[model samples]
Target: MELVLRSYCDLRLLLLLLGFSAGAVLSRPTDEGKEVWGYVTVHKDAHMFWWLYYATNPWKNFSELPLIMWLQGGPGGSSTGFGNFEEIGPLDSNLKPRNTTWLQSASLLFVDNPVGTGFSYVNTSDAYTKNLDMVASDMMVLLKTFFDSHTEFQTIPFYIFSESYGGKMAAGISLELHKAIQQGSIKCNFAGVALGDSWISPIDSVLSWGPYLYSMSLLDDQGLAEVSKVAEQVLDAVSEGHYQKATQLWGKAEMVIEQNTDGVNFYNILTKSTPTPAKESSLEFTQSHLVQLCQRHVRHLQQDALSQLMNGPIRKKLKIIPEDHSWGGQATNVFQNMEGDFMKPVISIVDELLEAGVNVTVYNGQLDLIVDTMGQEAWVRKLKWPELSKFNQLKRKALYSDPQSSETSAFVKSYKNLAFFWILRAGHMA
Candidate 1:
């Protein structure tokens, strides 16, 4: 009887060991306290720099965290420089800790994408992205390689967050990423996307610019008519696949509207443009703060870790060889001028994302003229969603709160899986 009892105990212990082994194999590795700073090589000479910040509370498990990939506007802008320092990061201009940073609950990644923005660079000018599709493809490869290297964060809910021209880039990249995930090429969990004052659907966005100015009483009927005429010319150029002409014409028409207005501020329309202190450049201050932040990295990652071993060395090696001629990302912005369908409609893509059960939050400052709340709501009403009429009919709720409490909160409306927030007395920087 004693021998039989001993054998049963051994069998139970064996089963327990097997269960432990299985759990170890299936579970994702935890990256609670880690930071990653590296480059992602997308083309022969294109390298995109990325700096990822882990959630502030490292004690919390990784599964509770949401990872946000932040992209700044501008077809030629730098996400790391502008988005990180000026907009959202750990510190304010005074070098003090930000009271309410997105970093509190989420893991944020600031990438200098498109191969030439910020610290990212291109060894060859020919490899620059020319169109939205090329930019999307390059970003997709970067995401794939980025995830492949850091498998521990694959299970976290990921989001693409952007503003301005970067919003357009995010829209395109989100579609490509959706396809890759469906094809099993990308195994990460994609949660949703958010756009702030996005440059989406040029047809809808640009068409309303003149009318927006007109409604604000900034332009007279005759001036409005002239602006509309220029807009129509822009539409004609875009229709005929002359994107460069459209871009230039659009710029001229926008300038006319700006000149007509009360010194239009892209950031906040209600306020006058303030002069910067002559002694201090914002770039210098941001760079100064970054110097300390980078040095604090526990283990500095190198560029070779991001290279994909597809070609002999083009994609696999980190080549910092400088060309005799370098224009940062000017060539890419120049090439984008001629991109045939770069400014095409993106509402359909957004509609598809909403239908796929992705959460989309679009918040705009009420005072912004570049991508005004009026124009955004107009386009939102036009989207072919299931509850389009209901959403359009849904009354916005006005919330009154102290600026310090909620920071001038305003009207809000939600329908289906999408929501829009109109920030009070805010502008493009909202």
Candidate 2:
């Protein structure tokens, strides 16, 4: 399914502040303070695009704020298009100022990662990344070039925030960036990573779908059985190291779910009447078709008004994007290239991050069905980190966005450098 990941260092506080003053500022979009956008050639024929918006909070200089790099999921989602305008960037899809934008708390940097997503471009299909390590290595080159040219941000704390598949990418990128920092190859205050409803363990999520849907009362016993059977096939494929088969099975399982639930939204079970599935007979389960099937799951995001804004006004404003490289033009290729790696789990990378003393925060929306809370907890419990036992023993603390409101917005539990937030009444993009 199409997944979107977001990052926040102190996300709880950020959410609280946004709740306190959402829509407090309303005006036409002005000059976003010291905006910077450009292309970074990370490989021989692969170029990645990044846009940075210096913090707008007037009392503090931008350098004093943390730099948040947002990575969007889909294995191909455009952070510049979806993550920026639709979520945390300074403007909304209509180009109006977004008062609750993340720029209120930190500098925002949106990168179209993996060379073939968003404004990023590849001259040849071979330049598309085949796996997470290649994605991380390319990102490392981008970061080095960015820091080398702008030494002012070198000492600033830099955080990687990702959602869905982006979270898997963030884990690899964060570990690589940490190693580069230690080796003095890249100079920066590398901080932590926040994974929001990530696809770190796709099989775990796929396996949980039947039970989660049944628990929500969306499926009958027969429907659950059908879903469970397909899910088991997926598990068997993954267990046998047949990842391509597993990816294909994953799509079949999604189609089974859609048929049973009458096109229930994968991102949020509470939402209904999602687009109907295309006929199975008309499709072949090739790598490209698998990616296309996943894309169809989130077709609303594929071609949207944000794409237009990015390609027209935003492209002209940057004045650097290759004219041939339309935003999200080659995203399907990006997803297709990652098909074999799609079902692989990155749970070990998270354990390594925790063992290395990196601050790792994971959050999930209560209503997110694609990467539901059950799956998130399942993979987290498998972590080999020594502090996991102590972490589990800690009681979750309730969080409220407003002091006067009696309603709880979320719950958080933490020990040492790891934390998890369970956000209530929110969906995948939360």
Candidate 3:
């Protein structure tokens, strides 16, 4: 029997907002003149909630700043719940300003993605589909409508960034936006995409984890052998086109590693035997923070009143019986039956983007066991680009971190518009 470690195959590293210079910043809102939060009716009953964050510090031409739209991973997770509340949003748990918030430079838009994730909701259960195309199309509709309403942001340089499965959505969205731009359907700078320890290919990522665990000394000879044996079964399942089964079997090997390691946190083994699974955060605590932000920051925003800002109609349609407890994590089992959803050819997509002169960067935390650096490196190697061979030949140029846990805490190598950072001693946004 497969040990089935909790949420093993799902790895989400909250991505960094690009274009932030090392400039001093204040925590007040920059675009205080604009609407801070709103909902878009992506479908008849599916409403996606979005909160805008200006560069935390004051800037003269804040409207000219690049825009970054962020999504959280779960195939069903909420960017509002995780990315904004738990990870990189402007506020701390008590709704106080977080000194390290990424909004210090780049403006951010965090939406509870797909349909059912976060504050986003659909009227009917059947309205939910986890396929990339449907979600991407809805994203297009939402974005078009957003730009139409807020014409000022339409021409700004826009970026799509995601963690985990959001990265999957970002890929499809990027391609769609490219086409839309050519057709003159959208009027945005449409920069590129950044993925944080995202799940690119189930096959490549799954096959890589066991060997990485072995190298980390978490797997002994017997554990390594068992993992390898299970990996073969996973490979067969994938080749047979059993995507769901392949995902299950792929997770089995890591589950075995966990069993042998006495249930260490797959995210960061050093975190020690925390009974809570390594891949998840405490929903209660995370939600508490989210509620605080909504009440404190959003409630006091300018344009709309508190009731209007909270959006009772959308909330009512969402069928959220409770007040604020409604926001938290979600398991996207809808993906199990979706073909090609487990593994899209993101490698090829990255290549296409690079060829088209789009700046693309994919980075992984070194200590991230959920999406181990080894697995990320393996997949990056498989990227079929003209300069790929040359990229591989170059050593990872030494990198520094003021917060680095080690002397050589990170290293990066880049060619043209593509760069990958291997952060040392970091876990999947833990």
Highest-TM-score candidate:
2
Best by lDDT: 2
Arranged by TM-score with the best first, the candidates are: 2, 3, 1
209-319 in candidate 1: lDDT tens per residue?
Answer: 778877777778887887687778778977887765566565555545555564554445555432322221112223333222222110011112211111123222324
lDDT tens readout by residue for model 2, 1-430: 3232234323445533222242234333323467788888899899999998887765556765678899999888888888888888888888998657788667888999878988899999899999989999999999999999889889888888887889999999999998999899999998789898899999999989999999988899999998999899999999999998898888888888888998888777777655555557334576556655657643445567777888889888888887677888888888888888989999999999999898898988888988999999999999999999999999999876666778777888978889898988777887
TM-scores for every candidate against the unseen true structure: 0.74, 0.92, 0.79
Task: Write one digit per residue (lDDT tens) for candidate 3, span 1-430.
Answer: 1121112111111223254432334344354533266778888867777777765446535565667898776566656545664566776434566556656446788887777665666666667665778888888888887778778787777888777667767877888888788899987788778877777765666677678777878778887787677778778887887765565554555555566677666556565442323322112223333333223212222114222323444345445434532443222322322323655446676667777777777877666665666767777787877888888788777643433344554567877678787766667653
lDDT of residue 162 for candidate 2: 88
Question: What C-alpha lDDT does candidate 1 achieve relative to the native structure?
Answer: 0.62
lDDT (C-alpha) at residue 359 in model 2? 85
- Ten contiguous residues with the weakest lDDT in model 2: 15-24
The root-mean-square deviation over C-alpha atoms between each candidate and the true structure, in angstroms, is 15.3, 4.4, 9.3
2 or 3, greater by lDDT:
2
> Which pairs clash in the backbone of model 2?
5-163, 7-161
Q: Give lDDT for model 3.
A: 0.62
Task: List ranges where model 1 is wrong by over 4 Å.
Answer: 1-34, 58-63, 93-95, 272-342, 398-408
